[model samples]
Target chain A: MVKKILSVAICAIVLLFVYAPILLLVVYSFDSSKIINIHEFSFSFELYKQLFRDQKIMQILFNTVWLAFAAAGLSTILGTAGAIGIFYSRKRVAKPLNAVSQIPVINAEIVTAISLALLFSMVALYRTYFSLIVGHMVLCTPFVVLSVLPKLKQMDSNTYEAALDLGASPAQALFKVVIPQIFSGILAGFMLSVTLSLDDYIITAFTKPKTFDTISTYVYNAVKNGTNSSTPALRALSALIFVVMIVILLVINLRARKPANKGA
Target chain B: MQRFHFSRKQLCIPYGLFLALFVVIPMLLILFYAFTKETDGNLSFSFSNFIGFFTSRAKLSTLLMSITIAIISTALCLLIAYPIAYILARSSFRKKNVLLMIFILPMWINFVLRITALRELLDLIGLLESQNYLNTLIGMVYDFLPFMILPLYTTLEKIDKSYLEAAADLGGNKFTVFTKVTFPLSMPGVISGITMVFMPSMTNYVVSDTLSNFNITILGKLIDEYFTTYDNWHMGSMISIILLLIIFLTMLATGGFKDNEKEARGTNLW
Candidate 1:
């Protein structure tokens, strides 16, 4: 009983450590004061209203979301196809290809960002949205390959062969038989790519044009400039993100529980 | 079946071309820019950029400071995460996945936002922009602790219970069983955890930037300044190459490359 209590206590403390800053962000979102003062506790929704009213913040939000979507979508398709190709190719060809794919995953983000920045400048494509998209795609695609490859390995190769033997065309066999088996991996990869792209700052900061600012670069600039850095609207944005995260967790939990309930 | 018009080899072309264009070529570009100097509209091979980096006391100190802070933060993360991971792995908790989700949910939020919020809280506690190493370490561990815990949890969870039982059956106590049977098996996770935490912590400037309010200069920040503020691409590329070398050495020291062959599916973040 004591051991169980100890374990629970440790878990509680760790979780508290993880959530404290988020909780603080949520709490401060409602503070009416311009600056964060622990002593001042004025409750208001004006910050959230202001967040919605701010055009620049809205633009940043749109850029971040659309960029994430584009990067994730493109990387998923490319990475999933790459994984399949690696799996089917001969060992000699596949080994080096697989190793090359992992370069982005293992390399430091700063290194990748700088290298891409250098490449863009050398090719005279610097500070373009195309550069930004390609940079993010480079950052995200490897993980997609990594995620999908495992699923491909676990899948039975004969399923596709059987589909071909049963009068299905090769393209049809690939689309219908092979893809469905690896769909979960693809979905996971897409989600991971979206999350990584959404969270990315180093690469985005390097490759984005001067006028283009994602939420990350925007927040970074706000903090760096120290002018209106502590705007309640920013806090509101944090609170909004925290709430969205909570909603995502709850939805994931509900979805996870449903299958178990059906099983039971 | 044998003579289908489409070949699997053809599928490799797009990604292979992408790898060459983006991955292979960019790295070559960094190397090219790092070693070549532009003089009178002509480029010549030179080591002046690299030599300048080593000769500058301030830059060398920044590099050392970054390494020091990374080491400290990685150590702190390990210390805090190991026990929690052990508890989670060994516990009979039915909702472990849910608990894991709770831990990882914060990571889903934008990292900069998390750091911003953390800076605010630290400001409240009189720690923000104090130029305190402890403050920076706290921010680093907070940002990175999940990376440490996830690997440790995965590895610890995979240990066979029968080994513990057998150790106990041989009169080994809890500590002995853990030391003899559990710790050695979890080394891979520890190594990966170190890699995950150390590499990012060393390379990450945002955590220190936010927490220190741009007062602290690490190697990453130096590289950023050289690239963005100073327009010294040659120096920036040289520092990046050095950083890459450090990463390569760290991976080698940790046997990360060797383990890749055995666990080719890749590192698990989920």
Candidate 2:
């Protein structure tokens, strides 16, 4: 009993450590005063109102979401195809191919960003939308393959063969028989790609054009100058993200618990 | 000869092309740029960037500082995450995923926003400006805790209960069971967790950048300075290669990319 109690105490404290900053941000979002003085503690929607009223920040929001979806879509297709190919390949070939695909996942983001920048400047394509999207795609594709490969492993190895024996072409077998079984993995990979692309800063910063700005680059710039960063609007935005995360995680858990549902 | 053909090899075309063009060539480009330099109005491949980085006292010290910070933050994250993951995995409660979500919920927020909020929290406690290194450590631990916990929890949860039953059946005490069985079995998770947290903390300049008010210059920021402020790709690429070598050495020591461990990591991840 004492052991269990100790475990509970430790878990609670660590949770506090994780959530304290976010909770503080949520509170400050409602504060009327700036400059981190909460002694006055006048509660208002001042920061949230400011966040919505700012035209540039709102535009940054749209740009960030739009970029994430576009990048995620392309990477998902590339990654899904890659996973399927590797899953179907000969053992000797697949083993090395699988290992090679993972180099990006393990490399430092700075290294990846710099290498992409170097290669783009060779073709004079640096700081373009194409470079930005490709950079995000590079960051995300490996993980998508990783996610999808396990589901393929869990599936029966003969499903495709059976489909082909039924007079279906290879393309038909992939699109009709195999894809449905692994659709959940594809969806999961897409979600993961969206998150990674959204959270990315280093890659985006390196490859983005001068006129483009995401929330991360914007927030980093607004704060990196000094200790007196006046961008409290991020506080409200942070709280909003926290709420969305809870909803998504809960919905995922609930769906996972039910064996019947696939969320497609 | 005129007819089109399709084969399983065709599926390899897109990713194979992607790997060659995007990943392989770009990595080779970094190596080229790292070794090449402009001297007397000519671009020539030499070891000056390597020599220059090693000869400078400031650059070596920053590398040491970055390594020290990464080690400390990685160690702190492991210490805090292990028990929480252990509890969450071993809990009999049905709604433990909700509890897990509480620990993971903070990660979904933009990390820069979270760090900015951390600055406010540190300021409220009067530690932001006065103790720059401590705040940086605090911010890193906060930012990276989830990465550590998820792997540990997943590995711990996947351990067969029968192993514990067998250990107990053999008259092993709780202490013996943990040290002899539990900890040994969890090594894969621990190694992966360390790999995930250590390398990034070494170069994730934003953590220290947000936490310290220009009082610190870690290796990542040094690379950024070379690439941006000085327009010195040779120097920047050299530093990046050095960083890559450090990562490669550390992973070699920990068996991070071994085939067996790669299989262990690439499956069952949420």
Candidate 2 structure quality by residue, lDDT tens digits, A37-92: 76768888988898899898899999999999999899889988988888878988
- Interface RMSD for model 2 amounts to 3.4
Q: What TM-score against the true chain A does chain A of each candidate get?
A: 0.93, 0.92
| Docking class for candidate 2 | medium
What is the C-alpha lDDT profile of model 2 across B1-270, one tens digit per residue? 677766555676798788878999999999999999998879998999999999999999999999999999999999998999899999999977667767766665678778877888998889987898998899889988887887788789889999999999999999999998998999888988888889889988888988897688888888888988899999999999999999999999988774332232322223
lDDT of 1 at A237: 90
In model 2, state the lDDT of residue B9: 52
Stretches of model 2 off by over 4 angstroms after superposition: A226-228, A258-264, B165-171, B258-270
Residue B50 of candidate 2: its Cα lDDT? 99
Compare the candidates by DockQ and give the number of the best one: 1
- Per-structure clash totals for the candidates: 0, 0
Specify the poorest-scoring 10-residue window by lDDT in model 2 chain A. A255-264
How displaced is residue A116 in candidate 2, in Å?
Answer: 0.7
